[model samples]
Target: MYWRTREELSLENRLRRSYYELLRDELDQFIMAHALKESYENFKNNNVAYPFVERKELKPRARIPKDEFSLHNSFLVIFVEDTIPQAYKKYIRFFDVNKTTKTNLLRSKTLSLGPDFDRSQKFLDSVHFYHFLKELLPVDYALLIQRDTSHAKTKHRYYLSHFHVRIDWPISEAAEDLARYLRYISKDVYEKGEKYAEDVQKKFFEYHALPDMIGGRRTAASVAAQYLRRLPFISTVYVSSSESRSLYRYCEQGVSRMVLMRLTTGEMEQVADRNNMPVRELKRFYMLDQNGRGGIFLFRVTYGHTAPAMPPEDGKLREIKPELFWITVKYQHLLPLPGIWEHPPLRVNLIYT
Candidate 1:
């Protein structure tokens, strides 16, 4: 082919350059969003890190790792602006990268570098979305702790693990804006600062039935082990403080617990005879220890099986809810494992400042 004149070639090059620059300016209009860092003052540790994601940092979005139960119904409303000169685009088009793995909400923005742009102003931010995930993780995790999946066949109780109340960001419309808003569906989560945990937990405990407990001290670990060792069979004991109303610092301390003990039908009858009342009419169940002098509440285990005999891992306790933080037992007379109080799963505290 005949070579084009140098003048013509230069003109062509100029036109191409101008076209490319226009595309660059248009692309700059939308800024890749990132999570802003904020201090979680309520956290006992104080100053937790919040993370945000950006466009340039998303090339490997597809390969990003995900966690289990990551698709839980965590939804949020993200408000973006429409502006010029790359101030920031108030909105992003819905970009579904891995429809099978709908984890990251920024998938579209990250993938837009190739051939995808849905310019829609509104979109869904599910639990798997990483960009703004950190902003609401505490609230979300707290919701999980109270989740009671107990059904007709399976009665699993998940008490609130650890929740730090957050007042930042506008969450009033969180339910209306998203279809998968978990707070709306959460039976345990109260509307903003309400002491709902106590009511929910009280009902759960009364229904499921917790074992009666013996008094405790640091040395009680050994004492409890020795006591349960002589029992006819292995006994599993669950220990947890009563769920207290949170959302405050320095909760006015009071007696919030009852030590319950497990006994038998004949034992109840004997106690009733001693108390001079029918077993059904007996108001109090606690009586003396082995010597029969000290009063201790009685809780006959109704279910054949007990909850997990071991302490729940950090992930289980990370959610905010009310339940005993400590549990111990003498299974075949083994030394008691460290309860949550002894070996805390999470450092975040809701009752104390």
Candidate 2:
């Protein structure tokens, strides 16, 4: 389920939630008032893509009477104005049915390439459309399709896995808008800040190189073996100060770290009892190295099963909210430390820049 901080229930969240809700509500009403049906044939085949199927072109086995040809899927066709030259109209269709194999309940559809659609713009537009529909219609699953023919190497083709996001819990209108805005800002920044983007990529490669650095496969397995050796007595291990220092630098540079631990069924029970949470509820656990001051923040493990987790009271210690949790975990855990501290790792001084 989605989790939200009480602090998130602010004016900003409320306004954004209202804005999209109102827009979607109005769109829904418009469709109903017009007696829109789920199925229909589009005769306007002005572009080379999505060729029209005339009666003669219909397959004998698939052919159906015109009266019986009702569209079984609900769709929203978005016509986007071009902000760049050589880009004509961009069409994004939202299908209200599950076509994705992983999750069967998500809204999925393909984006058709309009005449004069730029290759770069097509890709970016697909990403933008994915984020837009994600906020407009929150769902547990969503996908975007991008088509392009301009590339000299890859011919006219469809990019099926452009972007994806799952919204398992209900979100306030404001939170949704904030999410969309963040996505837009990130894309804008990446497009504008060439140096910054390159730096991030470099750091990402460095982080991936860690597994090789520590001792190739042998060293990596040794790290795992070290933890496995201690698994009998320790339910968890906290990162030491020195490791945290290294981790902080990596995080500042955008690396990621994973906590390795094996919990006994009894230890898990104790953890559940202590936290007043369920055993099956535990998914991914983490410790945050706030800034460079060596402060540690323990996060309840919540598998990427739903929205971010809500923080507990006091705001200092809480489950990672679904939205921010993954971002924070993937980036924050990069801090290096001395040793793995046990459960309730000692809190360090709070440091915020």
Candidate 3:
């Protein structure tokens, strides 16, 4: 559905979320079955089965594996508007190159500044953005669209295009929360379930380092977290690590041995499976396995919450955790927050920048 109103957008979001959740459940089942089969095979071949063995690297870069792995590192979040800034003109090139030229340039297999958009102002539209993104990402990347055309304030409505782009495989392999932003710019694209624009090529470029290359020197997630923390609309933020910190620590006994087998042969026999982890304590295991070690979850303040000014009468309500002060105080906003708040996770990187 083409969402023209906030209510329509919210409804569509809910429906889309339901659809994606069904798909996620199916994918989870498939993964479980496949993992079980793989485990049984491993037990037959090597006399041991890993509880949650993933044969494939979740985010493989050039088909290599290492102790430390980074996921969501290749993603870039951008807010694109109809107009480009004067300073940003140098970074953008107009659509002058032919189809063959674009193909050849991408096939060069080297990083590029990508199409400069200085002259693209006149002809630029949704199609241009699609093509720009096509050339900007790899074949495996997932393009998530969130069209921000509606706002209570008229000036805020720039028909801005906010994209959460990942240069990785399907969205299913990524965090489930990201699926909420999956939207189509046009109804035709939505109905067709496919967008054709001569298929853009993949080449790592400078755009991915956005906010950082512009002297922000912070990741997209970091920038977003910083901005959202101050807003009265936001109640809390949950940040998790994305990359695997220690291979041995996160890996199952069988997987650890398997990792050892791939890396070295001598210690395979010596490695033993970790004691059976309880269901309640599998949070870290699940986090590492799902490649969701690092993720930012934002909880917004609802109407039910007390107004920003009115702190609850209870002293506990007035008291803010010292942990949360790092996030609130860092912005130099000394105003005591309302009672409605969730204590920040102790392990999270409070100062993301």
Candidate 4:
């Protein structure tokens, strides 16, 4: 073949570069269109992470990780939002009392609205709400705490909060129990004409059931866990334990947790044994002897049969702690393990905070 002139070759190279650039632009457009369409579908489906996907500051196009959603266990999951005391009136859909209850709430001088409602907010913030609901529901439950921003991207950064609770009860049982309690409260209000009806409603808060996804294949807790895992700092994913059968076996065999608690030295020992940890290890981990009852702690325990227990090498436990610095730093206390507290026979209740 004849050698082309350098000018010809230069022109050819320029043409090739332009062609590739045009192809790249078209490919980018195709991907962008597909992504936007997917996001719209997600929004329509009420996916919690949909609104935040398009924010420029949050580059992450929120997508649930498959591994994160691998908890196949059946449980009832409920979501509660906008239940803060200051925002409860504005966001009435959460726990709207009847007209009578409202008027009663206003006239009841015995009920201290300020401290009572503020306690509600504190209950949620400190995760005591999880324990409170677990007791009310009377089931072993796991709580996934996330900031309000995790649900949607708005002007507000972190002034509000929301959470998901996974109860060990069957969905049908949970639904029935909730309905029964609601009915009981309504009947009590009508018959007794109690002044504390408003207080009961306030403390009860409000929650809606989240059904299973994919034709009952994917659990509600799994779906919520997946979505929350997308934002590490703003979420706490339940790490399931290998020895979960112990709790189930306890349920079946009528094991006395009170006896188990009695076997331990003190409250700390009770928590430690409940978590399958030795008291000495628990004390060392929390520095209980040094810090006393009220000090900074990093206690973590896993429940459920999702994964095998893999203890980290000595001196490296902190590395695997949940990425919830915003909460852990402020709270500075151990969250009660639900399985331990939910058992009715347990005389020594775990610390709520």
- Candidate 1 has its poorest 10 consecutive residues by lDDT at 245-254
What is the clash tally of candidate 4?
0
- Report lDDT (CA) for all predictions: 0.23, 0.26, 0.23, 0.27
Q: Where is model 1 more than 4 Å wrong at Cα?
A: 1-253, 283-353
Model 4 lDDT, residue 217, Cα: 19
User: Between the candidate structures 1 and 4, which one is better when assessed by TM-score?
Assistant: 4
Give the range of the ten consecutive residues with the poorest summed lDDT in model 2. 240-249
Error of 2 at 57 (Å): 53
Overall local distance difference test of candidate 4: 0.27
User: In candidate 2, what are the lDDT values of residues 1-353, reduced to their tens digit?
Assistant: 12233356567545533443343333332222121111111211222221112222111112222321122222212211111112211211223233222233232433333454333432322444333333322222223333334474543233322222221221122222222222322333244355534433332222222221221221222222222221111111111111111111111122222222223355445555665556443322322222232222231111121122222334242221212222222221111122233333222111111
lDDT of 1 by residue, 1-353 (tens): 12122355466444533443342222211111110001111221344321211112221111212221211212121111111111111111121232212233244232222235232211122222232323333221111111123353322222211122111211222211211121222322343245443333232222122222212121121122222222222222112211110010000110011112323456556656764666554322233122133222212111111233222343242232345322222111101111112221111111111
- In candidate 3, stretches whose alpha carbon ends up further than 4 angstroms from where it belongs are 1-67, 70-73, 78-219, 225-319, 323-353
Q: Which ten residues in a row are the worst by lDDT in model 4?
A: 251-260
Q: What does candidate 4's lDDT look like per residue over 214-309, in tens digits?
A: 112123333333332222112212222111100110111111100001112466666666667676665554332232343222222112211111
Q: Using Cα atoms with residue i matched to residue i, what is each candidate's TM-score against the true structure?
A: 0.15, 0.19, 0.23, 0.21
TM-score (C-alpha) between model 3 and the true structure = 0.23
| Residue 144 error, candidate 4, Å | 5.1
